[model samples]
Target: MGHLKDMVGANVAELVVVRHGETTWNATDRLQGQAESDLTEEGVKQAQAVASRLAKTAKHISAVYSSDLRRASETARIIADAIGCPNVTEMESLRERHLGNLQGLARAEAHLVEPEAFKASISSDPDESIPGGGESLNQLHLRSKHALENIARNHLGQRVVVISHGAVLRALYVHAKGCQPAGRVRNTSINVFRISASNDWSLSLWGDVNHLQGTNLLRASQRGDEMR
Candidate 1:
């Protein structure tokens, strides 16, 4: 771990949050939810690009944490190698929101099959659950917040990187910023947050994909299973 306690004072921690690279589901416009998918070739490049960017930009990254999902873990591994970090701590709490029956459906198919359920799943209602089995947005918020709080507390005065899914990242963004994120989170995009000694959080960056410029891997349809 690379501690920056001396440089950053003992009370503050900077958390760098990254969404995993695109998976085959993402390319095909399918919902992955808790279901798993392998990263596409472009996804691998995106991960590598972001990893290189972080290695060049971040002064000190004490730890790397990732959702245990294969997509996220793979991205974290690439980044860990780029940053010379030895290991990544995997946390199930950081996984994507479970979409239940909507897990593998394409967006259009989901709407066609169960419009009402789809609407509810995408709605802002924190308590609304997707049909079948899965977590509500409110439930997601709680777990995401709890996971982030724990990480911040444990790594105070250090810089840590967290690799997670889109929905989970949105939940955390709303928790920190008190507003829905402005747009879709691109694959391997970086979001920066500052955690005060008291654990109060502030967002400094969100959905930044400048590192992916010229990669030609950006997706056209922002609508996806995990995001909706």
Candidate 2:
């Protein structure tokens, strides 16, 4: 928000989108969706670690954006403070896929409470929304696409950091890259992409957690919930 309009721009825009740090719900095997949860102690450290990595290794950041949820906003604030970016634009479109009645419920509990919704969530058509008020995978993909296109169009030639959730990032990955992520998108993992002047999407990096190389925390099961 700092004279972003005044600065001359370039032909391409770089977006370094990151998933928020781990939360108490994440640790407890609960689905967060659009619900609320705070970061754990390790989550705080993970944010700090990613912030440090961005400060040291990334290009000059022109803006910071975050999902309006607490976890994503908190992570964005940490990274913004570390990198000297003063403003973070929180957008609802950046929020996670709404899990509807399944929100705040752990996997087993969700299956027990809403059997049909649970079944749909795991193996339903992409066009089907979850029970209650949740978004389907197709809905999420479209939202992610539009949000990213808007951001790229608004800030052409600049680099920005977007803090978001797992499902949202997964949507972005699948829609933009045309393939699923190879593994669980780790907490605070940095995924880089660029949008050209012609509005074409290109991937530059994925699941980069070099900041946490010494830690033993990167062993997320390639099999379980990428929607966390």
For each candidate, what is the lDDT?
Answer: 0.84, 0.81
| lDDT tens per residue, model 2, 1-228 | 112232234988888998888788887888878889898777888889889888877767999999999999999999999999999999999998888878888866888898877776776489988888888899888998888888988889788999997888788888668987765778888888788777788877888877777774454212124354
Q: Where in model 2 is the C-alpha error above 4 Å?
A: 1-9, 216-228
Candidate 1 structure quality by residue, lDDT tens digits, 6-123: 3554787788999998888998888888899999888898899889888888867999999999999999999999999999999999999988777888876988876766877888
Q: Which residue pairs clash within candidate 2? A: none
TM-score of each: 0.92, 0.91
Clashing pairs in 1: 31-225
Top candidate when judged by TM-score against the true structure: 1
Model 1, TM vs. native? 0.92
